[model samples]
Target: MEDNGNSTACCVKLADALMSMACMDLQLQSSIHLCASDNRLVPGKPLSPGSTIISDDGTFALGFFSPSNPKKHYYVGIWYNNIPKFTVVWVANRAAPITVPSSAVFTLTRSSNLTLSDGNGHVLWTTMAKSRISISSPRNTKNISTEAMLDNTGNLILRSLADNAIIWQSFDHPTDTLLPGMNLRLSHNTHPLQRLISWKDIRDPSPGPFSYGADPNNLLQRFIWHGSVPHRRSPVWNNYLLIGKYMNNLNSTIYMAINHDSDEVYMSFGMPTGPFSVLIRMKITYLGKSNISAWTTLYSEPVHDCNIYGYCGPNSYCDNTDAVPACKCLDGFEPREEERRTNNRSFLLGCRRRKALRCHHGNSFLTYPSMKVPDNFIYIHKRSFDECMVECRSNCSCVAYAYSNISSGIIDDTRCLLWTGELIDMEKGTMDGDKEIAVKRLGKGSAQGVVEFKNEMLQEIQRLTGQQGSR
Candidate 1:
């Protein structure tokens, strides 16, 4: 509580306190010392008494504080000093709270780990992922870069001058909110992938339902999973061939950007030219929805309806910015039921054509403009628009095809995406994407051929994956 009581102009005193805390633990008595907040965050060991960890901009301070009752217990967390609110992004001791408020000390153990322990010698918190493998800075970084800092991007990092690159960050091990630069990948990197797990309760920082990330099995799309089944799914990347249509919309400009660095690929959206810039964030809601939001003068609404996953039924789409509701059936098709009303409503039983593809004769494609493609598709790289079409059509089972050039300064000039089978969850977009697609329409005969083709193709897929087909 007295950490912030000192004068504003004071310095070096806090630095001294940090160095003094290192003496509490025998293992850290030597290498543990303090570095000022300039380029380096003052550090001793994580929980040494008198030592305080501050963010680079001083927007947040990391130190010991009690969660609710400060007089009886102490917790190590990061919070804002300027606001009337105590916004703790991370808490080092969430499960264990010191009872006696005994003289607490945080030190790097002989095992090369930073740990928080009671003055009576009780370990409460630690930074080691696994206790079996002793923590080591092979380069002896902690002795070099010296301080662990919370950077401006909300990343708490440990760096050494020897290798300035980030060694550890809280982003990689998310507690609740997904911060920028965090890759929520599958722990197994295979089928039955995981998603971003939320917290158990509002205050309790434990894993909850509603994890979000790309579906490894159906990777052309991102999904929010409630345990195992898909709670919600993003517009499948269906050859989402280059949807980069950067337009100068008033002040804030929205452009999709993608890049690769060190074998990791990521994409981020930006509004580079905005006045009094505000936070534009996206999150997988607890109720299972992907929301893209920006801080308006007063309230925030879905920037576009297409932002919601599965707003329209399969082979149908949401066309926001239109006078009517954003739902529209894909071209060359109509709702299957005779009782179908031409209005915006959410329903599955996707559109069916008056012109049935009987697989008896001609097959043609009806092109749609400014459309957010469908889900349940595959990615076929290095294929031209025509090549992609042929790949789907020759199979006879291939139902539809959507191709994007991706050459609009984002992806390969010749990169193509191909789709087969039923088209689901599509919507018309503000931008027509960079190119168009050709959907093959089958006559009654061709339709029958497609059904047979699909059966045989399913067999090959099962064989390839070494899965037994149903008897």
Candidate 2:
């Protein structure tokens, strides 16, 4: 219960003070320091470079950990407190875990900033922050009353007890996990769009090849990027929601919900109400596939089979419920190679066009439904299905189109995506399932109606003239 500085916040825990005690009461009387975990540090006990300093509220924890070798280097990290089986949501020194024992420590300076330093006082990692109120010359934060905390919602915040203001928070600088209320925004408006980057490997906490972000071009759908290519995609948004299908077997329905506030729009998921509380999370695996898992089940996932992204390659479909192992091409489409061989040993080479299109006035569209549509599409603003059809037919460059009615309050309150060239990584669904797409087939006879009309008119004129047969 003391006011040493003019600031308004209180320091909940001090590493120097806490290290002397085995446990301490978290309830602050006049002191305003407030993180939920009770942690103790000792001079002889340096946390073994692998344990944690958790808050009293069971919200966040600070610990030295490694997903890889037990005897290897250790990274300072923050993770959700209640979730079972350690899920490291944020890492302070992702690229620089401490290799040597007793060589690292986490501290808050006098100016209220958090930094991780090695034995020789070399800063391996630090949080990015700016002062809330400017001082005369930006005073160096020597030992200001600041602390690192993990919140109930899974945000690791670097805050000052002197003023009750957040200097920096992990919500703004996420590594891979995107909780219920976090904004994945533009880096500098000129960078190549910000995204959720996964780990290089399960055991390694470095940046990986897979990243998830909203499509900058349209921002209507979420995309999974591998390098710069479309690795996979979420369902196109409709009214800020995507309710895939009601599964009678699962006995549980899953759907996406979009929320918009003063700054950004974020997406989250929910399940049907039941006796068991179901919590869902999306994790992008090292093998480059996004998986959705439920908290209530032991190991039950709706779509964890073989068909995802382009696992089977282009134009090929994987039938999940088939008796023997299922992967095949559509009726009119043919495999790229005929002698490629059997199911288990062969990969999806995709389907090829049975016949070429003239792109002339004699083409017609063949509707192929029950599909998981292709990638690389641009959305057309506020267009109806019939209008979309006309627009595609009028343009020779356009190859395929898909439509979803979204009241998203963006341009037209409707979503219409178009593709110009190749159809890659598609699949077919069953009559009862919901991964349906309508594939358009443009053939030479596609424009036969207009051609037949013109030919008929020419013949009539020839008959009337009686000598114009050659023309």
Candidate 3:
């Protein structure tokens, strides 16, 4: 046990050398594989709860986060990393959340799939819906190396290193917000129509009743639907470069682009570029309204509830130009239930025909200019003014018709739209729209009908257009 000074120094050097060699061996082992996060994971290396991967630009981060009721469920999601608020944009286990957070692990499996599993190996969620990688047989394992990246634009991509191909992307499947570069496809050859559905509530990310997308039957127009019912419709696209542009509350320009080809027809939004930093998103709100919101302020498409579908009921039109938004009856119509009329003369019971129509008698058409056309229209192409008039005149069921000479890009340029059945969700004084509708009504003295006016405004409007001629 006794040692000289020189011998003791030599022993210390030997110990130091061994320690250095072990540290070098550890560093080499770490360099063998690449990880998505700083504490990256390779095959068999999983991310337990509370771990995360941040984007290179630090704009977004992917991690496991819980909602308001943390004990109920936990989700693997992506959110804005730089913002003060935790705004989640993408969710991995949206439909099936992990009920037990402490027992969950998010991992890239040996089969090159991103999966979430419990401690007992119960698979909770996975990106295996369209995986192209091959699974290993009994003796051999697949060595396909994959990496997860959160791109600067907030896209989470699982990429294969072998051939540099993306296995899956978060942009393809959106929950609520429609980012700038994401495409909202109206029609696709192989896939169903793509849309953005709102969340169930502020505390829950479940799919809500509100949805925003293109009209499936007519791809030219976009619509916001409330549980399969059309709520609000966008103006038909003019086939121009910019479909619509608005200066958001944050003083940034947000514009939408329309693409139409033989394969697909889609729309995508764009934010202001160059020097300015801003993010804009189009979202369907839980209350069934489509809103384009920025970081600072939110702007709604249909500003008033009267603009919503069927708010004013059938045969009546919502008038938003007035100081107080109100509904008005068409010429020669009265309130369906006159007893429900208030002292201020507001018609809560919609409208009904003042004079009942006889199919055998001759009827006249009344023209109303600058109006938002009603819903449930039948489109007929290649029709002139006289032909459109005859088309409606020939059928006793045709109640109204509107004509528009759309630009060439649409399916039919010379468009004639006719409406039958109940005329629900109409609007008057729509300055942005430039179409006129001709409605059929019985001629004066043709039936035992009495005209009743609830208010002076409606009575004055009836007097001004009562003499309108019909062909």
Candidate 4:
């Protein structure tokens, strides 16, 4: 486990001369200076654009790197140093990229502030002192010693020489990826929720529309939002020490945990440390897919396009049990007017009721099994099966109802979810729980010929629904 925000409060004490000693050891062994591996930037020894500082374990590196094309623009960032391919984790000046690489200089000022500036002394980025500390005027403090070091965990920290007082750190300002030992704040009590914003594209490190973080409106659930709309969602957090433990292709287990205390509530996931842990990263790709991958078998969530939020439009259910996941109309429903053509290949417009329900004529519930409940549902509580059924039955506006005793919580043990409007973002075979939904529809007796066709269609639906449940 790791601490939050100011990590030094609980950080393991390391000697101030740790970086010097490490550099000295390397010099003695290799007799190299310019290309030597020294994990710190001491005052007066400004780090140029070409040079880089590697973590003690050499697992990560901090230096200037360019995305898209190396000659175009350069940004100071931390990346996996040992990996064959350049995989950056965090960027210092994301919006501001230095065009001329030769003019870039990363140095520590007399005030112990780490600054990334150009040859003309134009400050691109800086880790300035907090409010309490004063650095109003620059002074030649020959006696003062300050240095910046890259820790083994890939965290870049700037500390004072007298005492290891952490002035700033990279973990406090995360970019896209949530590395191991990273704390993602889930509440705004102490600070705003920490979110992971995806890169604009493979070539651009700028911020994109996709972001993953705690839902402010509802603290219980986490969402992957594309702009303002949710793309994928995680089940409500129940303050579990361990929510899920998934095994990767490399046979390593990744665990997700919900941790909290008096001050903060947050979620973080990590794999086992030591040699067993391989290089892995959880990222939301530019195309809006959340993925967890190691060197081996990494998979993306919402695997099918049908699983995407409302991809099949309103009143349509995505069937993933089939050879190919697709959308289809529910029973007693047909495609909407303009989309009713037999030649229509896409179900983008979805479906509408074949015969509008008449409350006076009486309607019946058509149970659909193995379902991922539709969005925009009202979660009603403390209701039995009969009570839940009546709750929807009494209301003419209620289109569907789903009852489940899925939660162990005291408040909403029996979930009686009711849907009033058009059902969107519905899918089958992807639900963790095999919950069935009963849709309210017009009930009418069919003739002999129509009865045979209806029975056959019902049998096929049951088969597919059964597969969804089993999946």
lDDT of 4 by residue, 260-292 (tens): 656787667767653435356677777888777
User: Model 3 — which ten-residue stretch has the worst lDDT?
Assistant: 1-10
Q: TM-score of model 3 relative to the true fold? A: 0.74
Q: How many residue pairs clash in each candidate?
A: 25, 28, 0, 0
Residue-level error in angstroms, candidate 2, position 369: 3.3
In candidate 3, residue 284 scores what lDDT? 80
Tens digit of lDDT per residue, candidate 1, span 184-211?
4432323243345654443443455766
Ten consecutive residues with minimal summed lDDT in candidate 1? 22-31
Q: Quantify all predictions' global Cα lDDT against the true fold.
A: 0.49, 0.55, 0.64, 0.67
What's the lDDT for candidate 1?
0.49
Which regions of candidate 3 are displaced past 4 Å? Answer: 1-45, 69-71, 134-145, 233-252, 272-278, 338-349, 356-365, 384-386, 408-410, 429-434, 441-471
User: Distance (Å) between predicted and true CA of 317, model 4?
Assistant: 1.6
Query: What is the per-residue lDDT of model 2 for residues 85-191, given as tens digits with 9 covering 90 to 100?
Result: 45666777878877764667766543445667888889888764665542222233343355556565556676655677877887777777655556666323343
* Residue-level lDDT tens digits of model 3 in 1-471: 111111001111112211222111101101112123542344565677645676665555677666644246677887655443457777778777777777888887767778898778899888884665654531232554666667767787778777889888778888888876777778889978888988887666778888999888886567888888888876544333332334543345566666676788778886656222324567787777777754444568677777777777788888877997888888988777662456533455678887776664366677766577777789888986557766876788988887654443635756677888778777887533434677888864332221121132234334433422220
Candidate 2 structure lDDT: 0.55
TM-score of each candidate? Answer: 0.63, 0.69, 0.74, 0.73
Q: Global lDDT for candidate 4?
A: 0.67
Question: Which ranges in model 1 have alpha carbons more than 4 Å from their true place?
Answer: 1-52, 63-110, 116-125, 129-146, 160-166, 178-196, 200-202, 217-220, 235-256, 267-308, 321-328, 331-344, 407-413, 431-435, 442-471
